[model samples]
Each structure stands twice: as structure tokens, then as C-alpha cells.
Target: MRSIISFLTMIMLSGCGDGVTLYPAKGTILLENGNPVTQGTIECESVDNPKKLNASASIQKDGSFELETMGNKGIVAGRHKVTLIGPAGNSDLPLNKQPKPQFNTKYRSYDTSDLTITISPNATNNLNLKVVPAK
Candidate 1:
């Protein structure tokens, strides 16, 4: 009985991922001044679907990033809203005690951010995102 239960669990776990297709995506983030944003996270949420399809990645020191979707190395091909988040001030501090983001807050929200991108199928999508700096 235990072995049968384990087999059933494995079958269920294997089917957890939906059948959404993903395309390879890579990109860089820079400020409007053309300087790379040193450290942050970037997320792209699908605007064409209501299924919460999204991809995200960490911005490297040189501002380069490769997006991943649910552990897959790409995003679903479609229009997506982009949002960026700066690194935390200090890891030792609590959330409230940490300093606010050094970049403009507008880039942190999908609704408020003007950034958008369209990912195409059968191609490696290379994106270049630029946003305003903090005042």
C-alpha cells in the first residue's frame, strides 16, 4: 500500500506544471542615463493571460539577466508587464528597518510602471530595459 501511494504521489507531482509554452529570454537593465543598474530583481508578468504566467531573474552586477519561468529558462511568448526591485539595504535588518529602494519606485509596480515587452516564439528574446532614477 505504501508503494502504491508513493507512485501516485509521484504521478501527481509530475503533472503539477501546466502546459504553458515558454521561450528563451535574456536581457539587461539600465537607468535612463545609460548606466547599468548594479543589483536588483526583474519580473515580467503576462498581460495577455489571466493565468498568472510570469518570469523573473536577478540582475547581475553588470546588469545582465536571463529570465526563468518556474525553473524553466524562459518566459511564455506574449506581452508582459515588467517590474524591477532594488536590492535590500542590509540582510541583517528587518523589512521595515531596511532603507527604501534607491531607484524610482514607479519601476517596482507592474500597474504603475510603463515598461513592457513582447516575447516572440522560436527565438531568443533579448530585451533592454531602461527606467528613470530616483529623484
Candidate 2:
């Protein structure tokens, strides 16, 4: 029926939106001691978006990452405030349960991290970020 066909069309187009272009973003995160962060996530909150849309990428063992926004393959173009979440600590637990050391506290929050980057279209957004090691 016509109604059934129309419903199927809408569903197919739901994932498509205002045609906003996203730029590819990739990076590596390092500690001041020149070591790579082994695990966790890196988030980039769009500073110019009222909706506060963010792009995030999981930190790989080599400290490398690639950003994705809302299930897409890239990030929205703009200035972004970067925050890093290191592996959770289980130090209080049994010795075997303790996690590898995390990054400095200041890099865990956007307000205190003091890390920002501008993402531009048609340009390679490869970045290298360094944080202080946990004390």
C-alpha cells in the first residue's frame, strides 16, 4: 500500500541528516615522560555547538586514535575541547586487580585539561597530544 511504502522510505532516510560534512580526525596521545597511553577514550566536545555534540575515539595500545561522531566515520568541523579518560584504577583492590597507571588528573576534565584543537575541512587533522603522567 502507499502508506507502507512511505513508512519504509522515512525509515531508510532516518540516518541521513542535514548533510553536514565531517572531517577525518586521527591522533596520538603521549605522556610528558614520552610514553603512550595504553587504554581508554578521548573525547572532543565541539566548543561552537550549542548542542554540545562531541566526537570520541578509543585510545589504542599505541596511543593512537580516530574520531567518530554519532556513529559516523569523522568529526564535525570546529574548535573542540579535548578530554581524556584513562583506564580505571583498582589499586585499592587485590594487587592483580589494579589497573595500569592513569594519566594526570588535569587531562581528565575539559575545564582543567587546557587542550583544544581546531578541525578544518579538506585538511588532514592528524594531532599529537601530550599529558602529564600521574603522580
Candidate 3:
């Protein structure tokens, strides 16, 4: 009976399903203060539709980020947009006429700004972005 229960547990675990894990892309971004900007948000969208394949990640205090996709069960491997939004100050407030806030601006509470990127599928994408103060 113990052996049978063990076998059932194994089967159940194996049938959990496929899942995809995402890691930080290669590259670094330098901020105006000369500090390596590591904390930010990353959004992924489908290349064909430019609306599908939505994914996001928030940089940890240690300057690293990790995001997971639902897996390719329905999403096809291809090019996608990976937008990076960094924290910005109160200057990113929403406009009176704008119903929905824009990228990066939405993170104003945390002081983040938008930084869009393009990435291909089936492989890890390494990206670095440099942000300069608005002169």
C-alpha cells in the first residue's frame, strides 16, 4: 500500500504541467548619478500582435530581477517587446485628459520611468539601458 501511494504521488507531481522560468537579461544600465541602475520594471509583448505575451518583473533591492511566463502552451516563440520602466519622481504624474497612465509613469509612487525594448524568443535576451537626466 505504501508503494502504491508513492507511485500515485509521483504521477500527480509529474502531471503538474510545463512552466517557463525567466532570468535577468544580459546588460546593465547606467544612471545619471554614475550608479549602475539595476532596479526597474520589464514588460514583454508579442511581436505579431504587439499586445499579447504580456510579462513583467520588478528589480529587487539587490539589483536583480526574475520573472516567469505561463509557458509556450499557447504563446508561440518569436520576437517580442521587452519594455523597461525605471522609477521616476513626481514629474511623471498623469495628465488630466489621460484616462490610463503611461508606462513608467504608473510606477511614479516608486519613482519609475518607461524604457521599451525588443527581444526574440527561444533564447535569453541580455539588454542594458542608460538613463540620463533631462537637461
Pick the lDDT winner: 2
Off by over 4 Å in 3: 1-27, 32-34, 38-40, 49-51, 71-78, 82-114, 121-123, 133-135
Question: Candidate 2 — which pairs collide?
Answer: none
**Candidate 3: clashing residue pairs, number:** 7
Q: Against the true structure, what is each candidate's TM-score?
A: 0.80, 0.81, 0.42
RMSD of each: 3.4, 3.3, 8.8
Local distance difference test, candidate 3 = 0.48
Highest-scoring model, TM-score: 2
Runs in model 2 deviating more than 4 A are 1-16, 88-96
Off by over 4 Å in 1: 1-16, 91-102
Residue lDDT tens for model 2, 17-79: 566678899999998888998898999999986667789989999999999987777888889
- For model 1, what is the C-alpha lDDT against the true structure? 0.84
lDDT of 3 by residue, 7-108 (tens): 999866652144432333444555546565455655556555433655556655434454444422123345555555655335456655332222234323
Candidate 1 lDDT over 1-135, as tens digits, reads: 999999989866653266777788998888889888878899999988679787899988888999998777888888999998888679899988875554698888998999999999966788988878887
In what order do the candidates fall by lDDT, top score first?
2, 1, 3
- TM-score-based ranking: 2, 1, 3
Q: Is candidate 2 or candidate 3 better by lDDT?
A: 2
